[model samples]
Target: MYEIIFNLHSFLAYIVLAILGIALINAILGLTGKKDFTLEKDFRISLFALILSHLQLLVGLVLYFVSARGFSAIQEFGMGGLTSAARLLAVEHPFINILALVFITIGWSKHKNLMEASRKFKTIAIFYGIGLLLILSRLPWSQWF
Candidate 1:
């Protein structure tokens, strides 16, 4: 069960990052080009990225509770007893990822209430971009390799 959930979480992360990158790049391009936000493409892309990212978060949440390197690690080590790698896996990654999701959600909400194309693009660019950066910052790069 742990292996299945862990693999799902890891696999979904790649998809999430790809969609988020596409959405972020699209927003940046739209903002710079002063392009109109179209429902067919821009809206769908952002929505897809948001949904997929949330799904990844959910999977990660489950994995965190079940994996030995996650919540159980903290319980075993009592925080101060943890090494840097263990702390990253057990705490920092999950916490930062949740915060990133909040920023992404905020960006989605703010974009919906906007009337101007530029403002919408700008809102997503700044907020989702930050979210992306946060996710990247906390990723277990060494573990992946």
Candidate 2:
């Protein structure tokens, strides 16, 4: 169970990263080019990125609960006793990812309510950019490589 979930979470991370990156780049282009926010391209990519990110978060939550490298390590060793690597997996990664998701969600919501294309592009650029940075900052880069 743990292995299946762990693998799923890892696989999902790659997809999430790629889509989110593309979304961010799309947003940046829309803003710079002063392009109208099209449902076909701009909106679809952002929504896809948002949905995929939510899925990744759900899978990660399950992995966190079940994996020894996640919450179990915290429970077994306590917070202070965990090595930096253990703390990175058990604490930092989950917390940062959740916060990133919140930013992404806010971006999605705000984009929907905005009347102007510029505002929509700007909203996604700022919020999704922040979310992407946050996720990148705490990822277990060593493990991924």
What lDDT does model 2 reach?
A: 0.96
lDDT digits (tens) for residues 1-145 of candidate 2: 8889989999999999999999999999999999999999999999999999999999999999888988889889999999999999999999999999999999999999999999999999999999999999999999899
What would the per-residue lDDT of candidate 1 be over residues 1-145, giving only the tens digit for each residue?
A: 9889988998899999999999999999999999999999999999999999899999999999988999899898799999999999999999999999999999999999999999999999999999999999999999788
For each candidate in turn, give its C-alpha RMSD to the true structure in angstroms. Answer: 0.6, 0.6
The regions of model 1 sitting more than 4 angstroms off are none
In model 1, which residue pairs have backbone atoms overlapping below 3 Å? none
The local distance difference test score of model 1 is: 0.95
Local distance difference test scores for all models = 0.95, 0.96
